[model samples]
Target: MAHLQPKTIVIVGGSLGGLFLGVALKQLRKNLNIRVLERNPTCLLHDQGAGIVAGQDVQEFFQRHDRTHTPLAVTSHQRLYLDRKGNVIDSEDKQQHMTSWDLLYHVLRANFDGVDSEYAKAPEPQDNEGTAVYGYGHQVGDVEIDGAKPLVIHTTTADGNTATFEADLLVGADGPSSTIRKLIDPSVQRTYAGYVAWRGTVPETAVSPAARDVFVEKFPFFHSNGVQILAYTIPGPHGAVAPGTRLLNWVWYVNYAEDSREHVDLMTDKEGTRHHVTLPPGGIQDAVWTHQKEAAQASLPPQFAELVAMTTVPFVQAVTDVISPAAVLGRDARVLLLGDALAGFRPHTAASTNQAALDAMALAEAVGRIVEGEDAAEVLGEWEARVLEYAREGQRRGVEMGQRSQFGVHPLRG
Candidate 1:
């Protein structure tokens, strides 16, 4: 890698996936020019990724690279399953740590920029400063190779002007609606998994005492014939973990046949805007939220229902699955797709972020030889195989887990 190092690298999307790859590459090569482009006007974008289950890959990445690795999660040691009457039907002790999406994003953005400030609330960069730069309010407009010498990344600036950058390498971490993946193979698309998640978070201080008693310090799960719900605790804004300041995060997965009337209705918000990917918070119509709350009362245990009732703004994430035909694109292997851009999984596994971390590490190892013009085809072929296999297994596992929780679940299995 050191021998075949490129002069410049450009990464699209400033979320965890892109930032992690940028950080990983910087760690791998010193004085390597890197730049990250994000569509948000600022690195500060509000989120719906309420909580992340800490995985070893993300944990290790921070340990090895981050200058001031602050503890970033809240831990729970048990899982509780309850009945309609609020009695615990089953419980298991499996210690786990959870973090908020915003906190993780903030830390990574700061680390990528090598900035020491409250902007991302991460430590100052120990060495990197001018080596990498982050551009906000920039949307990637087009990416095409300039005759195979350097890949061109065309972006639309904040004021609607075009800007282009030429890089020896381009990483597409642009998330579920990845422009890079689609550009490489227009036929690839996400397949809806016949369900959607209603996710929300309420502050610990807002939780009723009875609800708090059941949900606090534990991950609670409740299921009826057609629904499954789980709730856990995560730190509040900016990693606030103190008592009464933490958030009680919940995700409720409900099934709806694709192309059914029910599916279309849920996909449309109050303003009649239909979302292709997700219905962001504050977009769910009041009537729809009311109906969901009523459903919660009928399907969930008393404590879980109470938690739902306390939510002021709930959001919906359509569960979907997708895998790219190729991770390395073009004749030269200069274009690459990582994270959600490469493979998107149903959230049932809670491992998408973990997958992103693993993808970054694996791609960093392959890039050196791919760009060196020696073993380009062989190295990229091996890299794509490893990433695709890993993604396929995770996607299938998520679908299996979801099926096991749905209304048609086989009685013999349980």
Candidate 2:
């Protein structure tokens, strides 16, 4: 009898979703080879200074997988609603954990491939474990799959060199603009939600005493006609969580009709380049940000306006929604779509990261069954059906919440 050969899995996209799946698979099966390909040329991704609401699944993932045990989030003890005058009108006792994108990315990278950084230290490599590789600057050009043959992935390096890789399975976690998703199903596309979020963050020490008092340790929100702004505390630079070192992250959602002149202008950066989804920090034009600040002063609560004024480099992200018809694709179901590639949810639900964690956890649970002589197609088919339902439900809830908040229309009335 011949010994069974280990299966090779190739994951495209080194962001949170891809990293989550890679780490989970590496931990679950020591004999499975995993390779992660990222299009970004640099090893470290940009911080973006975005805050993520750590759902239950996310916290559990870290607890189960992360060995460093570094404090991952800042806890918000209450939810507060303020009027235009910054006076609290209503409050509820609720606790939530907030974390930074950079911190989470670094922690996952450490766990996936034993890469050490300022935020997390890598652990010692396990004996008898399969190989784990992370390839940066590798932009996937195309994927080819033949029946009963290994999948072929073609890529071009940053230096313009081309290479090929073979894998038993291909996973696409490359986010909303995923190249793999397009190849698999080009019919699915993202639709803009008629609004955009103007986001910024300020250091805790920089906030005024009055502003700090109202926002610190609380998830604060202010809603006006067709607009909403919210804020929470998150880890600061280099994942610092100390009182003075933390950051107060804020996002203000404003309505803009699709393709309107105002929308076009807002999406244009200072360099005269138009962006589709996000305008990163330092890209916003001076006039655009100045106008937004003036609007904030007139419409936002005094504390919210003050925080916006203190922001040095504010960014903007266009809200969008996308739901694919299927999660598993191609002959024999060898290709898989995960995370935003599977469904791009509105930010209202704050379930994007949590959804990715859930997908990773579910797949990890299914791998053992497939390895134990179960039909691969049947097992993966079941997994796909479960996650696709989850993604659709999340997308539906996000749309309803966004309509109620942004358009002031209840789903029942509609």
TM-score of each: 0.91, 0.96
Report clash pairs, candidate 2.
Answer: none
For candidate 2, the 10 contiguous residues with the lowest summed lDDT are: 1-10
Error at 155, model 2, angstroms: 1.4
Off by over 4 Å in 1: 1-4, 115-122, 128-130, 367-382, 410-414
Tens digit of lDDT per residue, candidate 2, span 230-297? Answer: 99999998799988889999989899998899999999998999998999999999999999999989
lDDT of each: 0.79, 0.87
RMSD (Cα, Å) of candidate 2?
A: 2.7
- Report the Cα lDDT for candidate 2: 0.87
Per-residue lDDT of 30 in model 2: 52
State how far residue 73 of model 1 sits from its true place (Å): 0.6
Q: Write the per-residue lDDT of candidate 1 for residues 381-402, one digit (tens) a residue.
A: 7878988888888878977888
